[model samples]
Target: MIEVEHLSKRYGSAPAIKDVTFSVEKGEILGFLGPNGAGKTTTMRILTGYLPATSGTARIAGFDVHEDSMAVRKHIGYLPETPPLYPDMTVEGFLHFVARIKGVAAGDRANRVQSAIQRCNLQERRQTLIRKLSKGFRQRVGIAQAIVHDPPAIILDEPTVGLDPRQIIEVRNLIKSLAGEHTIILSTHILPEVSMTCNRVAIINRGEVVATNTPEELLQQLTEGTGYELEVEGNIVNLTTYLQRLAGVRGVEQLSNQYLPEHRHKLRISLEPGQDLGRNIAAIVVKSGLGLYEMRRVQASLEDVFLELTTEEKPIDAEKTIHTEPAVDSASPASDSVVEAAQTTPTTSPTLVPESTHPSGGEDA
Candidate 1:
């Protein structure tokens, strides 16, 4: 359970996060997303009690982050973007050291350290010096340290930043496996990661949370209505111009990459969101002597939401589904429950996420 109320942070005249408020419920994974310098890490550090906000407050497990930082720290595990590794120490020794610092009982420290090493797939590297290990192993060591005390919640800052594809998946899978027993918050810039690993996402932009909602909700809210994507095989020039002229239509933007440089007869058209212009556009294209290859509504996606919420004054269709919470949510206020769950559980799986909760793929409970 976590609550961040009107959180703001500043370095002199420059602010990092401003008027940001959100919560994560027990057992849910809240994906923190943003571009570099978007204040993602700043918010995370505040939540984990690693950094104090210039103004505003954060609470962990019902304990105020600033007033009860020590108590809050006892309930949460934190791993920064760069793995904080002691190059001189072996993996086991480093983990042992972290366990003591985290206040793990001396009697159970060895077992807890071993369990962390095992769960993070660091068994083979347990005796190796942290500095000598590969980047991936070093990351695992960082994770091991975070979990050595078995805190109820884990906050991971850019967990996959420098890993290769395979290692990225490995780390993601490991995070996923900790569901139900350990609440986790994973921050990353990759949009697909939020869709794939989190139950909900909060996008921070320009030092403020420009948007906060499940991926799908944000997309729906951003879009004014439904739209279509078209691919034509011939005469795109006249056809595209014709489609732009139809009534109830907003505009048309062409986005295409020929399969090969030698290919030039095909075009991909993204219809601006508005009324039912697909049929009219279709008629015009066929009449123009161009063979239509494919025409279908482009459902709202995470990218749509990101673009719409981050920028202003872009026209959009109104038919998009942005009215209600995803069907899977069984909680009253989404922020409250999701935030609470973030302490004790990491969500079930890809399918368990609340329905209509994401831009495209579904999340598991």
Candidate 2:
């Protein structure tokens, strides 16, 4: 479980994330979506205890990320944009090393390493050196190290960034499999992956959270509902007026039928939220003596929602516009409230690795 509230982060006078807030329910995968420079990585770093918030608070498994950084780290497994890895170490050896560093019991290290290897589909590469592995395998090794300790929470930032298409699907499936057992926050630029892998999504723009809800709910909010496109042949002079009078009908627009045979017309009908009038439309067309050639349903997509929310020059008050489920407080399960502004604060913390060690090594913060 994870809870973040009124978290903000600023560098000098510039803020990277302002009043950003959202929660990941236990066993749920929340997609953290945003355009470039929208403070996604900033938020991830703060949650992982790799950075501290200037204000607000974030808790993982009931421990404050800032006040109890060590405990929070123990409860979370993080995979930064670049995975922390030891190029010279074999997949199993690196996992063992990570397990030790993450405080896994020495007696259980072998089992944990093997489990991580299998979970990440690294059986063949278990004995292969990380440097000798391909990019996909290296990525798997990164994930394996992150889960080697089996932490309850996982923070993955661009986990599938550079992998090939097949590799991307493999990683996506791997992430989905981890859901129900680990609370995950996945940040990526791939919209389709989010739609397929996430149970809910939080869209951020210009350092502020614009909307947070299920993908379907967000789509509904944007389109107000689905619509239909119809192709018919008949007297259409009063068709628009007749359809407009129907319950739940928002508007009807005639699409150009220049290429169609004479008397054939195309119409696009918009409907109010939660309304489905396909049957009624068909019945009316038949009763009116119109020959209905085609009828197709149209709905808003995640890409549409993302563009609509992020392209606005002004910040949107998520509570006032979008429908969001009550966020449960990890500290108090009975308390429910809408997610509000929470952002990361800029604070210096000790790096997870020493400068003398692998300089290119990623940090599993």
Which 10 residues in a row give candidate 2 its minimum summed lDDT? Answer: 336-345
Question: lDDT of model 2 at residue 65?
Answer: 96
- TM-score to native of every candidate shown: 0.76, 0.77
Error of 1 at 173 (Å): 0.9
lDDT of 1: 0.71
lDDT score for residue 109 of model 2: 92
lDDT to native, each model: 0.71, 0.78
Candidate 2's TM-score = 0.77
Q: How do the residues 220-289 of candidate 2 rate in per-residue lDDT, one tens digit apiece?
A: 6664436788899987644554565566678776777878899998887877776666766666566556
Stretch of 10 with least lDDT, candidate 1: 350-359
Task: Put down candidate 1 lDDT per residue, 213-272, tens digits, no spaces.
Answer: 777666656664355666666545555444444444555555534452332343333434
